[model samples]
Target: MSKVIFITGGSSGIGKSIGEFLSEKGYVVYGTSRNPDNMKNHPFNLVALDVTNPKSISNAIAEVITKEGRLDVLVNNAGMGITGPIEDTPTDEMRKVFDTNLFGAIDVAKAVLPIMRNQKSGLIINVTSIAGYMGLPYRGIYSATKGALELVTEAMSMETKRFGINVTNVAPGDFATSIASGRYHTPIFENSAYKENYQLNLDLMDAHVDEGGDPIEMAKTVYEIINTKNPKLHYKVGDFMQKFSIVLKRILPDRMYEKLLMNHYKL
Candidate 1:
C-alpha cells in the first residue's frame, strides 16, 4: 500500500512545497488550510483545518483517515513569526505566536498519536528552526517558540518509543517562503531604546531570510527522513554558516558567542 501523509499549513511555503513534492513521489497526500478555497487549484486534496482549534485538528485527521486506511506521516509545518524586542512585544501577541507555533503543533501531534499508537507505526516531523538554538534580536519570541518545540520533540521521542512511533524535530535556518509576510512585528517608537538599531536588525534578519535556500531542499530532506529506516532525533536544513553556528555556540564560550552575534547583527 502507498504511504499516507498529512501536512498542516499547506496553503503555501514549506508546507505546500512538501505536500506537492511528496505527492509527486506517489504517496497519498492531504494538505490542510483554514480556508481550503485558497488552495482550490492545488493538485492534492485540500482540507479545511485550523491547527489552533482542537475540533478542527481532530476533524482534519479524521477526514484523512477515513479516506486513507492509515496515516503514515504527520508533518506539523504550520507556524507564525513575531519580531522586535521582547519588551516591546505585547503579551497577547506573544501568546498568539506561541499558540500557532508551539501549542498548536503540540495539539495536532496529540490528535494523531492515538492513531499511530494503534497502528504501531508512524512518523511525526515537527518543523522547528535554527533560531531555536540561538537567540536573535528582533525575533526573540520566535526563537523561544522553536526552542520550546525542540524540547517537546525530545521528550516526545521517548514517550512514543515503545509504540513504534518515530518523532524527529527538523530545524530549518531560513527557507525562501512567505514567512516574512506573516510576521507580527512589535511596535517601535522614535524614543524606543532599540530604535537606533531596530531597522538595522530587521534588515539583517530580512537579508538572510530573503536569501534563504529553496523550500524544495527542505521537502527533499523530509522525503529522505520518510524513507530512512532510522531517522535521528534532530535534522537541520539551512546554509552552512547557520548550521556551523550551532556547533560554534557549543564550543565557544558564552560571552564569545554573544559577541559574534552582536557583531553579525551590527548591534
Candidate 2:
C-alpha cells in the first residue's frame, strides 16, 4: 500500500506544494485548512483543521485514519507569521502566535503519537524557520515560536525513538509565498520609537520573500526526508546565504553575528 501522508496548513504555500507533489507520486495525501470550503479545485484531499483547537486537531486526524486505516507521515506546517519590535508588539498577539506555532504543532503531534505507537512506525516533520535559529529585529516573536518548536522537536525525538516514531524539524528560509500577506505586522506607529527602522526592515523582509526560492524546493526536501532510512534531527531549505547564516552564528562571536544582521537590514 502507498504510504498515507497528512499535511497541516495545506490549503496553500509550502504545505499545498508538498501535498500536490506527493499526490502525484502516488501517495495518499490529505491536507488541512481552517476554511476548506473557501479553497476551490484543489488536487488532493483538503480537510477542515484548526491547529489551535484540540477538538479540530483530533477530528481531522481521526478522519484521515478512518479513511486510510493508517497515517504514515505528518507534516506539521500550519503556522502564521508575525513581525514587530519586541517592545511594541502586543503581548496578546505574541501569545496568539505561540499558541498556533508552538502549542498547536505539539497538540497535533500528541494526537498522532498514539496511533503511530500502536502501529510501531511513524514520522513527524515540524515546519520551522531559519529565523528560529536566531532572533531577528522586528520578527522576534516569530523567531521565538519557531525556535521553541525546534528544541521541542529535539526532546520529542529522543523520547519517541523507542516507539519507532521519528520526529524532526524542517526550517525553511524566505520562500516566495503568501506568508507576507498573512503575517500579523504590528503597526508602524508614526510616533513609535521604532517607526523608521521598523518600516525599513519590513520592506527588507518583503523583498527577501519576493525574491526567495520556489516553494517546490521545500516540498522536494520533505519528500527526501520521508524516504531516508535515518533522517537528521534538523533540516534547513533555503538559499546559500540563508543556510550559511546558521553556520556563521556557530563560528562567529555574538556581536559579530549581530553586526551582520544589522548591516543587512540597514539598521
Candidate 3:
C-alpha cells in the first residue's frame, strides 16, 4: 500500500502544495483545515482540525487512522504569522502565536507518536521558517515561534529515533502564500515609538513574500526528505542568500551578525 500522509494547515499555502504533490505521487494524503466544509474542490482529503485545540487534534488523527489504519508520514505545517516590535506586540498576542505555532505542533506530534510506534515506522516533518534562524525587526514573535519549533524538532528527533520514528524540520524562506493576509500586525500606531521604521519593514516583508519562490519548491523538498532512509535533523529550502545567512550567523561574531541584520532591515 502507498504511504498514508497527514498534513496540518493544508487548506492552502505550503501545506496545500505538499498535500497535492504527495497525493499525485500516489500517497494516501489527508490534509487538515479548521473548517473543512468551506474548502471545496481540493485534490486531497481535508478533515476539520484546529491544532490549537487538543480535542480537535485527537479527533482528526483518529479519523485518519480509522480510514487508513496507519499514518506513515506527518507534515506539521500548521502555523500562523505575527509581526510587530517585540515591545509593542501585546502579551496576549504573543501567547496566541506560541499556542498555535509551537504548542499546536507539539500536541499534534504527541498524538501521532503512539500509532507510529505501534507500526514501527513513521516520519514527522515540521515546517519552520528561514526567519527562525535570526531575529528580524518587527517579526520577532514569528521568528521566536519557528525558532523554538526548530529546537524542539531536534530534541524530538533524538527521543523518537529508537522507536523507529523519524523527525525533522524544513525551514523555508519567503514563499508566495497567503501568510501576509493571515498574520497579525500590531497597527502602526501614529504616536507609538516605532512608526517610520516599522512601516518600512512591514512593506519590505510584503515585497519579499510577493516575490518569493513557488510553494511547489517546498513541496518537492518535503517529498525528497520523506523518501530518505536517514534524513538529517534539519533542512532549509530557500535561495542562496537566505540559506547562506544561516551559515554566516554561525561563523560571524555576535555584534557583527546583529549589525548585518540591522543593516538588512535598515533598523
Q: lDDT per model, in order?
A: 0.91, 0.95, 0.95
Give a tens-digit lDDT track for model 1, residues 64-109.
Answer: 9888879999999999999988777799999999999999999999
Model 1 misplaced stretches (Cα beyond 4 Å) = none
The list of candidate 3 runs beyond 4 A from truth reads none
Candidate 2: RMSD over Cα atoms? 0.6
Kindly state the number of residue pairs that clash in model 3.
Answer: 0
Q: Give the clash count for each candidate.
A: 0, 0, 0
What local lDDT does model 1 show for residue 133? 95
Pairs with backbone N, CA or C atoms under 3 Å apart (clashes), candidate 3: none
- Per-residue CA lDDT of candidate 3, range 148-256, in tens? 9999999999999999999999999999999999999998998889999999999999999999999999999999998899999889999999999999999999999
Worst ten-residue run, lDDT, model 2? 188-197
CA error at residue 109 for candidate 3, angstroms: 0.2
Which whole-number lDDT from 0 to 100 does residue 200 have in model 1?
Answer: 80
Could you tell me the TM-score of candidate 1? Answer: 0.98
Query: lDDT value for candidate 2?
Result: 0.95
Assess every candidate by TM-score: 0.98, 0.99, 0.99
